[model samples]
Target: MKYQTKIIEKPADTLTPVGVYLRIRDQFPESLLLESSDYNSDKNSFTFIVAGLLENFKIDKGVLSVNHQKKSIENTETVKNALKDFIAQIHVRQPDKTKQFNGLYGYTGFEAVKYFEDIRFESKPQKDAIPELNYGFYRFIVAINHFNDNMIILENIPDGETSQIESFKNLVTAQKVPQFHFKANNDETS
Candidate 1:
């Protein structure tokens, strides 16, 4: 059976990081998905978080078709261990300087309180400031997903608004999806 890959890019204003993460976790089966990254830095750590969520779905049946780099870490035990290590490391590290730290940490529970001092939200902003902040967030998301060739990026088109499910569908239809193929061992395909 052919699988449907729906790349949902939640609106920065509307959906919190936890909400988006949960939605993605609940919707897809573990066996059907793969999070991609090269073990370069903490920047790609969110991929592991997503993979951890998928691992929850793989408790009974095992995950299949992992991109080779993550093949060893595909099982539930490994994913759980990775997540535990990640959290421990984040805690031990005191301040995570990665972009994911800024985005995901800001919206999560305790981190939200700890990092509240750094937040710059304005209840009553000047007209110019509003546009600038929106542009900044948009640019940030674009940059984060730039090197993620395995994941499909659904951009919020027409500039300032959040991306909708219809927008995701339209983007997928427009051939904006990633062109890379999953490789296992030496095998490759388009």
Candidate 2:
């Protein structure tokens, strides 16, 4: 699988992990920022920040949505099968191990632990329930090397993609994120 790599180096004085995250967080939900504050770390030392979704995986109340292509999965085996099929179908470019930092990055909730352990739950749906699992796959990431004080914008476009997509420069140097002010209509010490 072929993928495009974009490396953008800028002076550390001008750009920072927090600054970059602040600039792009509003543009995309689930914008991730991971920092390894330990100085002079090894090959694992990279601050990764990425927004926007190349694909999304979510399972809510037994309904699975892979990039908004939904399926009702009634059992764990079915859900596992759907995920295997959907995940395999989504990515055209596999991670190139030769690259410095490239692979699947995501978080899994503890419910998955129960599932793997064959544990059952006496669970009830709550208001504004979160998904059992929610994850996203990205095509690009802004990786900052703490040791070198340099930033590399890695854009991994699938080999099959030919259409135009947003660039790292545009994303990083774009307009300021909109700000919002919220006020409580009634104030009480409840």
Candidate 3:
């Protein structure tokens, strides 16, 4: 079985375990069941949440796990250690970076761009209307930007490569289409 993972490194103060878990679940809807367990034998208690996603209704599966108590730490050192362990497990899974990035950007409706210094066309398909031209891998620069309250910028996408920038842009733009706005009401009883 092949799976990928990523270690989240945000500070404990800013960590949101439930939010992360929910996001992961939403991304992998095929997951039928999610489980959380707590182990306590020594002085410390450890809580782990795991979710499984089914693929092809067969062997392919996706699993995500997180330490539920790690987000409640006040001591920086303890938090760091807990986060390290959590990250270690994530890396062990080795999640797909590109797919993860696409999922994140897609959800946020942010475009990511990569610039290619040099790009060349290997072969050009015959065009019935337009003349076909071929270049031996020419270099080009690509930039992806998003229009939202928060903007995300990715630069230097190489040629012959497809990315989620277009899809993200389209989703975002569609959501922002002209819509009805509600007015706020004021009360003067006090």
Candidate 4:
């Protein structure tokens, strides 16, 4: 249930991003996937988007487990408040910047549209979240071309500021998936 973001060396082409996106799709099986224009474009840009209920991320009754982050919605009022806050946050960030903004941007949405609204309006709270919850796990990754002199700036999305999203940031920052970790001995140098 741990969501990770790896900043590997950018591939020579869009093959790596496409591969990653496909791998995620295969893993999720029933996700609402979205590939940025740059992903399908002929340009050498690597941008991919994935959103849907994978195996681990789900919410049942008043309980929710998003990438292993479990929490109860408290009550109907609490759920409403949380949903309001979540929607507000989503609106603050433009959908198009999912890739350009960089790093894993995870959210519970169906498409790039009014997903939470439908949840808030359609589902009637019955001592817990009615109809059970199966929201998409939106994910975004940044492929670094020149990893040497560049740093990932964390200023775009407001999600990083909240304690709720601290785990997401921690996964991306502390536990980065190292792609270029090879040791070279002095004697072995060419």
**Per-model TM-score on C-alpha atoms:** 0.19, 0.72, 0.23, 0.31
Better of 1 and 4 by TM-score: 4
Residue 138, model 3: lDDT of 9
Q: Write down the TM-score for model 1.
A: 0.19
| Residue 65 local lDDT, model 3 | 19
Go through the candidates in order and give the clash count of each: 0, 0, 18, 2
* Candidate 3 local lDDT, 2-42, one digit each (tens): 23332222122222334333433443332221122433233
Clash total of candidate 2: 0
Segments in model 2 whose C-alpha atoms lie over 4 Å from true places: 1-6, 9-13, 37-40, 90-100, 158-167, 173-179, 182-190
Q: Spell out the clash pairs found in candidate 4.
A: 52-136, 52-137
Query: Is candidate 2 or 4 superior in lDDT?
Result: 2
Tell me the lDDT of model 2 at 109: 70
Q: Which tens-of-lDDT digit does each residue in 1-190 have in candidate 4? A: 3233333332333234344444444434553433344433344443333433323344555466554577665555655565444444432334443345443333443321232343343444456233254544344333322223222322233344322234333433342233545686556543
Candidate scoring better on TM-score of 1 and 3: 3
RMSD value for candidate 3? 24.5
Model 1 C-alpha lDDT per residue in residues 40-86, reported as the tens digit of each score: 55455233222211111111112211221232333335645643443
Candidate-wise lDDT, in order: 0.28, 0.66, 0.25, 0.39
Specify the highest-lDDT model's number: 2
